[model samples]
Target: MYYPGQEAQLRAAMAESEAFRQQIEANHARGPAEPSAAPAGSTADSSSGASGGVQTQECPRCHGSGQCNGCEGTGHKDVTDAVSGQMGEKKYSSEMCRTCGGSGKCQLCGGKGRTLPIW
Candidate 1:
């Protein structure tokens, strides 16, 4: 805990990291979610393996990058594990992101950078 003279440096790094985390969260909250289904007569893009061309518009979530916002393109995330009943809940660790399967891609797009539609 005692860096002798690196206190300022450490604090600055921590602040920067927190700011970055906040930015990622804010960006994630500002996007248009993918639609559930197509308009009825639409068809899926078999060639692209997309949702039969049901997408009405680009997903605001990843801007069509299909990258997962949770891991920020890192394909990994930090998580907490429960060790025991009461105290177990306090335990924590980092692991591969289940959302993107360590691929850092969006769930809806499946790393294809797009979404599917249904009728």
Candidate 2:
């Protein structure tokens, strides 16, 4: 059940989640934030400050690619079904990935390939 650096990775992920939650709470307490005006002559884009002043990061779960992890981007995966009354017996079947719903997108990022701090 243990892998190298798994504990550290889990702790880091937990800390990141906690920090994100706190940021959301603080933003909510301060009321709706006004979007800052983009600099003159600057191109408006999603990666720019024009994105409502909210910063986005590559999705940690999908690494910003939006590829389905469960099915390895194939939109299908092999599933093992347990047989009733048969010890250690199993049935193998290939089916659509529940995580991505057969769309071959990251479940966590909702296929955006990136994640915003917004709730």
Candidate 3:
């Protein structure tokens, strides 16, 4: 099934991209920093199973939104079967997201969108 507020989500996503662009620009304005500025034992990569000194890290599996990537949080998947109908016909249907079991959440994070520090 189509999730409610998809249009709103799209708008929000656009706004978020704008905000992210602004953030990048702001970071650029700060200019370059010394390599030693970063603390030891910390890393910039968030998806490397390391928390980089933070108490918790955003779940890499869902990108911190707690949404199922397989279905984009709609909890449904549109499937087309090529040989399910009359000659050369295709059948289309929607089904629950197998990755999330219809709950629309990331299996790794359990809808919290965060995980304990791996470091």
lDDT of 3 by residue, 14-110 (tens): 8999999999787656644654664443335455553332345677789789988887677787465656566544332467878888888889988
Give lDDT tens digits, candidate 2, residues 31-91: 4343353332222235543323445657778876789888767787645555476665544
Query: In model 2, where do residues sit more than 4 Å from their true spots?
Result: 1-53, 79-94
Residue 108 displacement (Å), model 1: 0.7
Q: For model 3, what is the C-alpha lDDT against the true structure?
A: 0.69
Q: After TM-score superposition, what is the CA distance of residue 70 in candidate 2 from its true location, in Å? A: 0.4
On residues 1-119, what C-alpha lDDT tens digit does candidate 1 reach at each position?
66689989999999999999998777556533544434543334456443322234354577667789877677778544544446434322357878777877787766665454422
Least lDDT summed over 10 consecutive residues: which range in candidate 3? 46-55
Predictions in order: lDDT: 0.62, 0.66, 0.69
Tell me the deviation in Å of residue 30 in model 2: 18
Counting only residues 3 or more apart in sequence or on different chains, how many pairs clash (N, Cα, C under 3 Å) in candidate 2? 0
Q: Which ten residues in a row have the lowest lDDT in candidate 2?
A: 37-46
